[model samples]
Target: DGPLARLRDRNQLDRADKARNFALAQAGEKYRECFFRAGLDPLRTLDPSQEVKSAFSPNGLWRCESQIENLQKFRAAREAIPEDFREPLAAIVLEDREIVDVGREIGAYKDAKMAGAVALFILRRGLTALARHYRLISPTGAV
Candidate 1:
């Protein structure tokens, strides 16, 4: 399961309203979509045949129009997030990393519990901002 699913299972999202939950899910899906479209997934491996050079694009560094648009959208969504919240959001949403790992990486908490809590909070706020940027949620309501 993903971080969001784990959060829901643990009732961490109990305080969030339906709209906020939907917005968060939408933001996450969009982020993942853009991430894959932009060819930024580190885990994806290209086949040898796919890697072979062709006459059309010898360097194999070509992007379709849709990909270009998604890349722009990805940049816009990323920029919409606050600097403090960006890393955690990307860790959980894009890389599927655990919140505790993210917390440990940030290194500001005295305990693991506190670190996870802070990381979760940062991720939620970042997702909210992204939802607003994508118009999945309103700026002033239910965020």
Candidate 2:
């Protein structure tokens, strides 16, 4: 599960907080899909048993066409958002980093509480923008 799933499972985010808010969850899924399909995810070296075999060899001569297309889409999506919001969005959505760590990296919070709050706010806004870019929801707030 990604950060959004973890948040939802922990009851931090409810499906019905507002009708529009549900789009955030859908957006998160799309963001993760793009990241995965682009082949940007890090190799899992921590646990050899958990590793899945890839069709492409380590020499990188074989390239998947879908992965190339997804990489273009991912780059376009990333370019659609504000520069400042990108890091936090990537950290949480793509890298699965904690909000607190993102907050610390952002570097202006007086306390961890404030840092987490700000990071969460940035993540939500970033995902909302992504949702519109993906057309998972309309620009006028219709899901």
Which model scores highest in TM-score?
A: 1
Query: Candidate 2 at 90: error in angstroms?
Result: 0.2
Give candidate 1 misplaced runs (Cα > 4 Å). Answer: 8-14, 43-57
RMSD of each: 5.2, 6.1
- Candidate 1 on 1-143: residue-level lDDT in tens? 88866775555643547657766767877887887886555464432224423532456654577755776788788889998887788888877888888987886886889888878888878888888898887888455
lDDT of 2 by residue, 1-143 (tens): 76777765654533455545666777777777977876666553221123324544465432578866776787788877678998788888777888878887886986889888888888877877888898867887567
lDDT of 1 at 58: 50
Instruction: Provide backbone clash counts, one per model.
Output: 0, 0
- Pairs of residues at least 3 apart in sequence or in different chains that clash in candidate 1: none
What TM-score does each of the candidates earn? 0.79, 0.76
Error of model 1, residue 73, in angstroms = 0.8
The residue-level lDDT of candidate 1 at 41 comes to 59
Give Cα-based local distance difference scores for all models: 0.73, 0.72
